[model samples]
Target: MRVVRPVLGAPSWVSLIAGDLDVAQRFYGELLGWDFEHGPERLGPYVSVLADGVPVAGISGVAISAGTGVGWTPFFGVKDAHEAARRGVDRGGTIGVGPVSIDAGRIVIARDPDGASFGLWQGRAAGVGDPPRQTGVPDWIELRTADAFKAALFYGEVLDWDAAERCEVFYEHERVVLRVDGRSVAALRGLDRPASEDAPVETPRWQISFAAPDVDRAAARAVELGGRVVRRPMDTPYGRTTELADVEGGLFSLITPKARPSATAGE
Candidate 1:
């Protein structure tokens, strides 16, 4: 796989905090055909997830018992971790962890105003690379919040995304699209989720979608591997998509990307 470095404020890495590292590894390894390698020691017994021999994500077993829920968090690259964390807080977000030092770089865990958790990293992101969107690597990352416009403002300020030189922001189909150097990287969608007296308020979160060659087969395999299909496979712009919860109930989606035209066509 070709390694491509990410730009400032772009997504750099993703990770899941699982209760049992062994079970998480086994489940994903079998389900997504992924390989694993030991992550930086400073991160403490974590495993970097590799899809087609390229690092795509990480799974850490250290914080599950410390009240951290099992969920996937996307990390964004930052030129300055301290400034990013401060900007997030200034923009109505909250910092849960630090701009602390690690072997690979400095990191900060924070949540947007809507309570969507995300991370900020300042360093030469080692595991960030350009791997073809496949069954294991993330194909898309989205933030589902109550107001996309409001959320966009918060992120734009925190990430300094308004820089005309490298980034572009626009709205489409009632959602805000974030593009880095002409390529759509992520989106923010406003959702109307009504809460009943009995139903608890749901927190906004960044959703990660992994690619699948066959969505239906992948959903079935998830069930066989002790996962639950939250949403049956259905056609969408990203191709047939299915929402799933891992063995530990960490939610993610599977998307079969739409095929592109062959480059040699019309030759």
Candidate 2:
């Protein structure tokens, strides 16, 4: 599969770290119609996920033994790993891993002040790139946290997003949208309060979404593969979307794009 490089300060890649690498691979491959390739030796027991002959994501067993939670973590592109990590630390984010060398690049995993986990990569990435919309690839990312503006400020400084020449950050509705080259790649939104007394508190984290052809059918197949539905499919302005957890409890969402109405017959 061919690889594409993401623009600096944009989302570069995403990874699922699990102790049960085989099961994780099996679950996602079946759920998302993905293929796998042996990943870089430096990543240790890793597999690169391919969608329609293009590398889109990865799975690794490197940090599971260290008690890292099993979840889909997003990595943002950076010009300098060390500088990004330093800025993140200065802005109240905590680094969990290193600016260590990995095959073609350097990476550092860290959590924002709100405890939302993310990564920084300063090299060629074989995942999300400019105009990131693609089949079976992670298509959208959202940060659910207590404060949207604060989260925006932290990421903006750490990722050097202050320059309008590269990207633009703006508020829309109740969320902050991060746009690169005219495309909105991610959004930071405040966590909604539980609607009733018995609802569970939403956790602060980056959520990944994949485009699926059939929302209901795909969700059903996920269940047959041992995954659980966190939220039943529901209609939204974007599309029909559902939240789900892999067998190992990694969270992600599936969204079927809202169909554009066909041009009026013989208009």
Quick one: best lDDT, which candidate? 2
TM-score of every model? 0.88, 0.89
Model 1 whole-model lDDT (C-alpha atoms): 0.78
**lDDT of the candidates, in the order given:** 0.78, 0.79
Q: Model 1, stretches more than 4 Å misplaced?
A: 1-5, 125-131, 192-201, 259-267
Question: What lDDT is reached at residue 183 by model 1?
Answer: 55
lDDT of 1 by residue, 81-104 (tens): 999899899888999889899766
Error of 2 at 250 (Å): 0.6
- What's model 1's TM-score? 0.88
Model 2 error, position 255 (Å): 1.3
